[model samples]
Target chain A: MIERLKDLWAHRELLWNMTVKELKVKYKRSVLGFAWSFMTPLVMLLVFSIVFSILARGGDVQWYAVFLMSGLLPWLFFVNSLMQSVGSIVANPGLVKKVYFPREILPIAAVGANIFHFVLQMLVFFVFMLLIRWHFSPWLLLMPFILILQVVLTLGLALLVSAANVYLRDVQHFVEVALTALFWLSPIVYPVGLVASQFPKFMPLYLVNPMTNIVLLWEYAIYNPHHYGPQVAYISFWGILITVVFSIVTLVGGYYVFARIERGFAEQI
Target chain B: MEHAVEVREVSKMFKLYHENVRSLKEKVLFFRKRGYEEFWALRDIDLDVEKGETLGIIGANGSGKSTLLKCMTRIIYPTSGKIMTDGSIAALLELGAGFQPDLTGRENVYLNASILGFSRKEVDGKFDEIVAFAELERFIDNYVRNYSSGMYIRLGFAVAISVDPEILIVDEVLAVGDEAFQRKCLDKIDEFRDSGKTIIFVTHNVDVTREICDRVIMLEEGRIVRDGIPKEVVNHYHQVMETEEEASEQGNRKIEITEVRLLNDRGEETNDFYTGSSMKVRVCYEAREPIVDPVFGFSLDDYRGFTAFGTNTALKGLEMGTVAGDGVVEFDLKSLPMLEGRYLVSVAAHSRDEQTVYHWQDKLYQFEMKSDIDDVGLLYIPCEVKTGPQAG
Candidate 1:
């Protein structure tokens, strides 16, 4: 592990350049290139706000539009990173078969590119919140900490899927179906409180889902339902510990599986 | 002496899959079936390249030459054993292996340099030199997708060579681009040799290996068959390849070789000749059926399978039209300029274009030449020495 880390460090510039390449290629030859990054979340925000307003017929939650944006933006970051990274290795067989620096660079660069887009979208969304004169809790300072957790978790899963995709291409298609199911399972469209209250008997089982815990932390930090909606339990001490432990475990385990299988990658491809 | 690269008991095995089983359904369907054949690409290969030495690897196709190179470069791991290198390595397994099409040439230069583990600061120092070397100064700012194939390859070669790695592993990349660029790359490699860095090169171009390599290894199948000085190992390679080729004889048999003989100036059949002496090659053929416009030719080749001389009656404007029975054709040579060596002769009878071979005996006849003249080379040249002062 130390040797691998040293090699990764020595080739840090390569990692940086590859990440930049991914970001640049994603935006090239399009008139409204980088703008497309935020458009997905904003469009989803618009459609969901209107649709949920009609479905609830006067929901009691205050500043619900801002509430959805906070959870939805970070959700896009996690989801898009996984989607792009799953096929990263198989897409660039030229780099994998012909050159050797660190094989992990391919998937890591894909995640890195999504990270840039995610940050850009978040900055724009946060500035728009300030312009709306919306009040944010002091807990919003933990947004970066929550983001780091999400990144580690996403990168871990990304590494696992990308390496598995090289051996069994069905893994990429499988990831698409799995992400759709996972999206609804997470509290992106609704609050964790609704799930906790509706299925009070299974609330522990629901918290076991890492994203449920993670999205609740995002709500706790940026949404801060304690300030907006008094009935909601936005902050949970157990949720923070679970999110932190789950993120680290996934990262370490995902990277371990990825490294073990990568030796067969050139031949498999 | 310090070794730059050491490969110890390294062997690589690859599974040749009968059917690709990527999907879950296919994997389940083939779960009980044997799905692949095990093929060993390299076998217990042990070699150490001394620092500052230029080593050459030569082999036929599918002989694991490229596999060994990929192993040394860490592009693929060996199935057994390990390869350790003392210094940083830059491998040109394929020119422009990772150049992104959307990126500009300047961006790709730094990008490709980074892929080979060179720092941006290092690339910054040699960036202009790379563009100049590739002759892409005008297209450096343009996207690589728009560059011509030759231009793209040139830029790849330029960036790879400019890295100036401690241990350079090159595989057939020198054969790329036009002749002039090849010459320049070779010259630059020669300069690298002078600077005392290690180089491991794999190429089918034996002549170039003879010129540049301090040591050469020849691979056959998955094993190294010969390793020595370049000249000796290359000769062994020629011998191995020539002997591997089966001697074949196929023809319509309208006119087939019944007998062949080599005679001296006095018209006596012999298998020995002296340099500068007259000789005759006689081919006797029996025509089982009437054949028209038949040509016969013979080539004298050294033991290394290099053809030294060859000619045919078709080229000499001699045509045998509709021959019926046995006949003799004599190739009369006034003098032989061959130096001292054992030579083999291949005689053939065919149509005018030599396409429809009536019969071909590939290196089936042998002879020896003796030369007392003080000279060295494939041919014995007549000379007269003159001693003179520095006056006009």
Candidate 2:
């Protein structure tokens, strides 16, 4: 394991270059270029704002766009990285079979590219928060730590699915289906309060989802629910601890799985 | 001196699946029931490349040459044993493998250099030389998507070549590009040799090994059958290939040449000879019916079917009476004209009028020609080079 780490460390430049390639290739010919990164979250916030504010009439939550965008940005990063990385190895058989670099660089680069876009979307989100004059949460001090936890968790899952997708290609399509289901399970579009009040017995099981607490942390920090509507949103001290521990475990476990099966990747790809 | 690369007890086995169960759905359906035939591509092979020595690997297709190179480069792991390299290795298994079309040529050079295990610091210093070698100065900033395939390969090659390393692993990549560029790449390899870096080269072009490698190894059926001097091992490589081929015959047999043998000066039967050495060709004939004034002839042709030397009894003014039963006719070659390479022998028996051929086997016999001469072309010609400033 230490040897592999040293190998990966030596190829760190390749990791950065590949990540840059992914980012540049993603919007290569577009006139708008990286503006699309900020555009996506803004469009989603607009659509959701109209749907919830006018149609659903959820007046219980003030400035609901703030609540939705805070969770939505992180969710987009999670889903996009997973979707992209899951197919990274299979997509680049030329690299996997022909070149000599740490195989983990492919999926890790996928997550790295998403990290750039995630940061961009967060910038857009904060600008909108200032525009709305939304009250700030004291928990915002924990924002950097939450972002790191989310990255660790996302990187782990990305490596797992990408490596798995090489052997079983259906894992690629399965992730697509699973992500759609997982979106609603987590409090991305909906709030944890809605689930806790309606299915109180299952709330404990729901919090067991690492994404649930991770999303709740995002909402707690950015939405600043203490000043807004605690009735529709919730964050727990225990939930924060569970997610922190869960993310690390997932990251370590994901790295282990990736290494064990990486030998088969060239042949399988 | 120490070994630059060590491969000990290395073997690779591939599982050939009957039905590829790649999808998750199919994998679940076929769980623990996937049927595959096992093929071992490499078998307990051991090799050590000494520092600064250039070793050549030559083998027929499916002989595990590529598998061995892949194992050495860590592209694919061996099923058993280990490979250790003492220093950095730059392997050109392929050209332009990881180039993203969207990236500019300038960007891809850095990306490709890193992909081949060169540090950015190394690339930064040699970046200009790489671009110049690729001849892409003006077009370096253009997106690779617009570059021609030739430009793509050149840029890819230039990156790998510019990264000087302790070891270089080349797998037939020099066969690409135009002939001029091929010469440049070979010159680069020669420079690498002069710089005293260890190298492992694999190619189907066995002749290149004679020019470049310090030693040669021939592999067949996943095992090293010959490992020695370049000329001998390459000769063995030809022999292995020759064994896989049989002569095409088309003639009626009133009289047949039952067997053909090549003998050296001492009349010892063999299939190997050297340039300027006496060789004897014995054609063992069986006459089913008596044939008069029959012409017995043989042609020594190189592998390309270009006749190097040929003769006939009639042409040489030899008249034979009726031959019956079994007898041997001998042709003595005072001194072999062959330089190097496998030579095929064909023999025939025909009526004097040439209306009837008794039996003719085309390329039925072969002999390996070894020589000390280093001159090029069809056959070795003895000559002296008179040189220099005042010579006319």
Candidate 3:
């Protein structure tokens, strides 16, 4: 583990280059380019607001657009990274076969690119809040830590999927199906309180889902600043801990699997 | 003296999975996992090279040359055995494998060089030299996707040689660059050889192996068949090639080779020919029915299967016509331009469309280069060089 860390540290320049190159290629030749990053979340929030408001028919729920944006922001970053990283190895089979670096770099490139988009969308999120009557508080200082958690969690899953893709090309399809199921399972569209009222087991289920903690942390920081207290801190800490453990396990396993079959990749690919 | 590398009975086995499980049910049940068959790519390979020695590995395709190089570089773990090496190793296995096409050439230099273990400070010091070597100073800022194939190799090779590695492992990387670039790379390799770095060179060109290596190791299938001086190992490799060809002829495939010959101007069989010598090659076929077109191509390949000179009768607008019972067909070469080496002649018979292959033969006849000392490369291109200050 330490050796891998040392290698990553030694090759820090490569990581930076990979991230920058990823962002460039993604936005290149597009009509709107990076603006589309902010536009996507805004559009999704507007549609969800209109649909949810009609479905509720004048409920006690306040600021429906803000509520939906909180979940939409983190969900978009996580799901987009998960979907793209599944083919990270198979798509760049030439790079994998020819070079010997941390194979994790391939998946991490996607995560980094998605994180860039997520940050752009966050700027739009703040713009919407300023347009309304909400106040930006001291809790906004912790947004960077919350964003790091989302990155770690998403990258950990990306590593596992990219490695599994070498043996099972169907992991790409499996991830799409799995993400659809996970979308409703998480407290994205609705609050945990609403789900807990009917199914009392939703609290444990929510805590088990790493994104639940991540999304709630985002909500506390962005929408409900007063709610940022010891409970949110405790959840963020555990989210970070889980992310670290998961990322390390996947990184090591992926590296070993990659090195084991590294020779045959040239012949097979 | 300390040894630079030690390989004790190192072998690599690959488990080839032909039918990959695609569905969730099959993958969960592990149904298709049992179909994998294990094949040893390298077996009981043992050798050692002292510091500053250049060891060349020569073998046929699928003979484990690249596998052995990979194991030595620790790019791939061996299935069995162990390797002990000293110092930091840099392996230039594939050209531009570490490069990102979407990234600029300048960015790729730092990215790929750092991946190979050089620091930003180190690369910065040699940045100008590397660009000068590749002759891409103008395109440095442009993304690598815009670079041509030659430009890519030039930059890739430049980064590889610029790093002062203690041990450098190369595999056919020199085969792609242009003549000038290849000369520059060879000079750099020579500099590395002069320094005390252990170099393991892998190539299918026997002449390259003989020119650059202090020792040569020959591998057949997965076993080390011969190891010693380059000339001795190459002779053994040629002898084995002959035996293997004879063995394959007796196999289940029934399209047999009856006779092969090369004729002179008067149509008499001769073993000697010179550069620019107009020669006739006759190949006798013994099939019950006529083989149309038959491709009837022959290539003068060096001992390592690197083709030196090759052309087909169909390609030269000479149709072999039709042949029934037993027959002989001739290919008249207008000019044979090849230098000194033990070159093998390979022939193949395909359909008129050249899509479906009917029969193929390699190393059917071997010839020697009898050209002048000034001749070079796979083919001898006549040229005159006047030195002593270019007419100033």
Better of 2 and 3 by TM-score: 2
lDDT score of model 2?
0.87
Q: Which candidate gets the maximum DockQ versus the true structure?
A: 2
Instruction: Give the per-residue lDDT of model 2 (tens digit) for B126-219.
Output: 9899999999999999999999988998998999989988999999898889989988988999999999998899999999999999999988
lDDT of 1 by residue, B195-306 (tens): 9989999998888999999999999888998898997688667655664573456777778899999999899999889999998999999988888888989988887778
Clashing pairs in 2: none
Residue-wise lDDT of candidate 3 within B1-392, one digit each (tens)? 26889988998888777675556777778764557879999888888888888888888899999888878776667888998899888889887776877778998898778777777888999999999999999999998999999999999999988988999999999999778888888888988998868899988777777887889999888888888889668766775665366422221112234777887667778766776677777777665566555556777766666766678767788766665566666677877776655666776666668776655765757665566656557677768877696675
In the range A64-104, model 2's lDDT, one tens digit per residue, is 77788888889999999999999999999898898778999
**Pairwise lDDT winner, candidates 1 and 3:** 1
Worst-scoring 10-residue span by lDDT in model 1 chain B:
B239-248
Could you tell me every candidate's TM-score relative to the true structure?
0.84, 0.91, 0.72
Candidate 3 has an lDDT of 0.74
DockQ of each: 0.71, 0.74, 0.23
Model 1 spans with C-alpha error above 4 angstroms: A231-234, B238-246, B250-300, B303-360, B364-376, B379-392
Model 3, position A257: C-alpha lDDT score: 62
Q: What is the lDDT of residue B144 in candidate 2?
A: 97
TM-score-based ranking: 2, 1, 3
